[model samples]
Target chain A: MISTHLPALQIILPLLAAPLCVILRNGTLTYWFAVVVAWLAFAVSALLLQEVNAIGVIAYKLGGWAPPWGIEYRIDLLNAYVLLIVSAIGALTVSYAKPSVDQEIGGDRGYLFYTAFLLCLAGLLGVTITGDAFNIFVFLEISSLSSYALIAMGRDRRALIASYRYLVFGTIGATFFLIGVGLLYQMTGTLNIADLGERVAAVGPNRTITVAFGFMAVGLAVKAALFPVHAWLPNAYAYAPSVATIFLAATATKVSIYVLIRTYFTIFHHDFSFGVMALGDIFMVFAVLAMLAGSAIAIFQTDIKRMLAYSSVAQIGYMVLGVSMATVLGLTGGMLHLFNHALIKGALFMAMGCVFYRTGSVSIESMRGLAARMPWTMAAFVAGGMSLIGVPLTVGFVSKWYLLLAAMEQNLWWILVFLIIASLMAIIYVWRVVEAAYFMPSSAGAPTDIQEAPMAMLVPMWVMVLANFYFGIDTKLSVGVATRAAKFLLGDAS
Target chain B: MEWPGLYNYWIAIFLMVTGLYLVMAPQNLVKKIVGLNVFQASVFVLYITMGKVTGGTAPIIAEGIEVYSNPLPHVLILTAIVVGVATTAVGLALVVRINESFGTIEEDEIRELEEAQEDAS
Candidate 1:
């Protein structure tokens, strides 16, 4: 039955709707259509997640051709959860984009904005659901291409330069990923991920495969904004319009982090993950570095958006560090962090959009006394930021709790110390912004009397913020699912 | 050992590296777009080369030789190429806007202006 392969349709519907959004040629209609299609994709992803939870794994072959020979869309517990996160956030973000897009982009270019948004969402989903190694690269380009367009659509002239810089970096990342695939394909003569895994196991100690792993690790490291290689992220996120920043900041790099986990742990096996270079140590080192450096850099930023961008780099470090432990608990922590951070940051970024909507500027100094002016918006920021700081009752805390436990399990006491220190750094930066908003003197003389943003924005913002808190308490949807996915990703290796 | 044996992959590698270098080092925006094209073209060649049979011809349905290059990579690359072109066009379009707004086509100069603006504020 065609219905059984709902995982494929979760990606396919939006993939089909992207071009339709373009051809429809009306910004408002295209906007609504994209939102609908995105939600429809979310619905399909939820269904698929349920099926995966009940059953084992779902692999749907393209055009009735079996895998390793034809394209395959594989959904296990891991990807099914990712599919749900990506599609749900994408749908809500698209609805939020409608009014924000209309306010930012002029009438003529609005249609293009929605079109590119849909394409990017579709591409992210495609990358999430695909089982083939090379298809990952293909879908990566789909998302990257649309992302470049979306970034460039910013009204600010600096956006073009920012988009170009991002293009250069993004292209490099993709090239590196491709070379990795090519090298692997050369050794194994296969492009299917599962088949490549099998053949790679046979080849065992081939230098080519090791080199391929290096290429992919670095490529994904850059894409995920692991510090030092994260130069393109701050400006791209800061300069792009709020909608683009929110959508990408929430989902894109997080997805790359997922790919890194999948390729390293699932596809390559734990032996490869721990062998040769003692990769676990290397990852812990870099992840800690990212954590410290990102927080320190964000502390000094005057621009609120750029600060969040740097914060994302730091958060990515936690996820990578979690994965670096190379155990079930570690994998669970990292995977859970990925989901938790997405929710918290997604909510935070949406809150920033509200601030931008009211103030039309993202300069932190410009937002003095904004807490009094737009209390709801500022409150959302505080909520998300508390979650970001991993307070006792937030999703961020749950992620951190798991990570701390994982570190303890590994008996890496220094890592535990580093995590605590890094979180203190997070508190410093977050408190800076909160102090400015609530405590700093009103810079605009009378606080500028800026009203709250429209319901179109606030409702979505609250939903994400509330979800962060709600999921923090429940943990069943996020933790239960991520725990299952973690077992799946590490099960075979373990 | 012949013209298309291992030589094809070597060519693919060469093109791929060249494209990557171009994008990395270029100062002008349009050159970067061209670089992205070459990079994607190289990927295309890799996929196409991988699809070849020992003595195969095109993948048409009526191939009497019973040897046809795999069509999957070609199809996938076609979609990828289209995506590549879309990205390039958008990059160039952004460059055009950059030209209009900043009145400069060079990355260095635009960066100078931004730094100056940041300092001025």
Candidate 2:
């Protein structure tokens, strides 16, 4: 009976907890409540993944109505994998949020911060679990709205502008998504994704459907911060509260990428999305640009958070590149990168959060001699950096290996060369931080007497850092799940 | 191309373009939020247009009614409108905060102030 209600409970736990956080109005209590709810959601996701592995796909109809007639919470290998990533990150981040948030945001607003945080978690989980097309947009808004508030809560005035810019772009993206959904519903009078898939194929190549696909792809691209439309991300990431930066950087865009995969592979099918629409070529070109441009721009940012934000754009490029490859190996690379990058970036951002808590700044200049003061945090950052640079025996290498194999399979030597060069570019930016944190003497303005971040922060951060190497060596959980999910997405069971 | 038959779509498209232009072309924060509202309203209109059947009545089911406007789009639009309103409220609240901090709500002025602060730091 409990297993049967896992789908509903996965979302409801966090959704209900958000209001409880507000009602409590005590910072410590609200934070503990959120952490408990997040961990509960994580457990539910793990159980759901297990059930999905046992059964094929678990579809829970809301109000006990069948699909195409009611909203459904559909859990397949794809979403189960994504759910684990989001919920795991949510749990870790909320636990880590206490000290980081207290230092950065401070005061009674802590209760409000946790409230928005829970709403964001619920929204993302809702987006992932729903089988209804319209429900995705609703949940997307829930997450996006809460994120705006969280970002605006930063101490700096720039944070307000950053939140505003993100709001404008995010609203436009969501509206475009809504228009796409409306267009699809017009063509096939169903809002359920499975029913739409069947009905859309039967409609067969209408101009409206093609345009609808374009709108949805572009909308998700904006949300995912792909290449040219990625203007909103760097500022939002750099200026948000440290904990918010970590949570949003790790999970929000990853969820958008999942939506992109669901739309192109599940609803539109590979042939329609890739072959008929010729999106593969476009995606490849933009992905390469994102890798080159994102890394290139990252090299110049003085702020460590902004630098990491740019690096995220590049990592997303790697993921999208794998998707654009349209091969089993390629998609495996993409999905693996999704999981791997979340771990790498989560650890990296958590390290940044720790630094900010100690120094009250995230500028590269402030980070000089940090390794001496906070060895554990800097060590974690170094490990995360190596993972970012695709150093061998790290999780980054595993995903990049799959991507390289996919490119080689297609005989795309040019793309192979670009991937290598981009990895090298990653080395340049990450080394900038390493050289500052480890080698340089303390700058005149840098704090001299700072200690390592609190155990609450370091523990969760190290968990992710160790996971980078642990999952790298033991590929069963991450790689095995990713490969299986990739095959399922590509409709290649064998 | 049946121009008259496709009139609703054309109107929706025009509104959408106008809204998108305003949002992009303006420096005033308030205008941008207004533009966003307009953009969302266009979407509502488009959805409503799609749901309309030629001789359809309101979607309440009765024994006499055979032709009914599709109710799904209406439901979807209603939810979307609520989302739009929430977004507007948040956007406006942000603008108010921006004004209080920087003494201006113009995008360019805020950027200049930020640049000056960065230089001073």
Candidate 3:
């Protein structure tokens, strides 16, 4: 009986714990409370994934009401994989957050921080698990709003402007998404994703659907921080409190990419989305530009956190490029990268968070010759940096390998050239930190008395770094789930 | 294709375009928030207008009522309105904080201040 409602509990557990954090009031208590809640959410997602693997699709009618009329929490291999990623990151980020949050945000506002973190977690999980199109909009706003609050809580005054800019852009993206949902509902009487999928196919190649598609694509593009529309990301990530940056970098935009995949592959038939609309060609162009331009921009950023944020945009391009291929292999690469990049980027950001914790700055100048003092933290950064560069025996290489095979399948040699150049750019950016931290003498302004970040921080950061290699070497779980999910999206279901 | 019948859509499009322009072109942070509100309000109008059934009364179960407009879009829009209000609250709160910190609400002024701070650092 408890097993039947796991889908709903997966979201409700975090949503309810959010207010309880405020009630708890004490910073340490709220920290432990959030940690427990996050882990419980992770356990619930694990069970949900197990159940999904056992049973093909788990569609729990929310409130016992039928799907077309009432909301439904639906989980397939695709979203179950995403749910696990979000919750796992939530758990790790929450555990790592106590030290960082206390140092940066102060204990006075700790409860508020945890509250927003839980809300953002629940929102991302809801966005991934829901089958109702309109439900996605509601949860997307919940996440985005909470995240804006989270970003604004940063000590830097620039965080305020970053959060505000994010607010304006994120609101526009969500409203555009609402308009798209409204148009879909106008055309089709039902708002259930499956029902809309069927009805939209029946409506067949109409102007309204095309317009809705455009609106949704653009809206999600903003959410995912896809190129050109990604102006809000670098500052937001750089200025937001370390905990918020770690969590949002790992999960928020990845969930948006998942939504993009769902819209492109599952809700609308592939033929209509790609063949008639020719969105594949359009996305391909933008994806290539994002890869090149985002990476190129990352090379110029002096702030480590902002550089990773720009790197995220470039990595998003990789996922989009894979999806634009519209083949099972391509989508598998995209999905795998979605999971692997989360691990890789999560570790990198956490390392920077540690740097921020110790030296009170994340600027490259501060990192000069700091590897000797913060050996574990800098080592984790090096491991994560290698993964980011797609070095062999790391998670990044696994996903890039799949992306390469997918590109080759389509005989797209030019895409291969782009991928190699982007990878080289990743090396350049990562090496800048390596050279400063390992080779250059400590700058006079650099703090002489800084020690390693606390064990609480280093442990979680190392867990992520190790997992990057574990998953990379043992590709069975990540690759297996991604392949199944990819096939499911392409309607192969094998 | 009946131009006269689609006046509601025309209004929604106009508001959307105008609201978007306000959001993008405004140098003042508060104006951008206002622009965001107008932009969201346009989407609300689009949703609410689409829900209206011509020659239909309010959605209600009554003995004499024959045709009722769709209630779903209205319900959806009601939720969207709440979201929009929350967004406005957050946006305005952020603007207040921005003003307090930078002592100016103009976007360009804040940028200048930030750049100066960066340069000094």
- Which pairs of residues have clashing backbones in candidate 3? none
- The prediction achieving the highest DockQ against the true structure is 2
**Every model's TM-score:** 0.93, 0.99, 0.99
RMSD of each candidate? Answer: 2.6, 1.0, 0.9
> Which pairs of residues collide in candidate 1?
none
Candidate 2 lDDT by residue in tens digits, B1-121: 5648779998999999999999999999999999999999999999999999989999888998899888778888999999999999999999999999999988899999999987765
Q: After superposition, how far is residue A13 of candidate 2 from its true place, in Å?
A: 0.5
Tens digits of per-residue lDDT, candidate 3, A1-494, equal 89889999999999999999999999999999999999999999999999899978998999989989999888999999999999999999999998899988899889999999999999999999999999999999999999999999999999999999999989988888888888989999888998888999999868899999999999999999888899999899999999999999999999999999988787788988889888889999899999999999999988899999999999999999888989999999999999999999999999999999999988889989999999999999999999999999999999999999999999999999999999999999999999999998999866689998999998999999999999999999899999998887787845
Candidate achieving higher DockQ, 1 or 2: 2
Number of clashes in every candidate structure?
0, 0, 0
Candidate 2 global CA lDDT score: 0.94
Once superposed on the true structure, which residue ranges of model 2 sit more than 4 Å away at CA? B1-3
Q: How much is the lDDT of residue A333 in candidate 1? A: 90
> Positional deviation of B51 in candidate 3, in angstroms?
1.1
**What digit string (tens of lDDT, one per residue) describes model 2 on residues A151-194?**
99999999999999999999999899889999999899898998
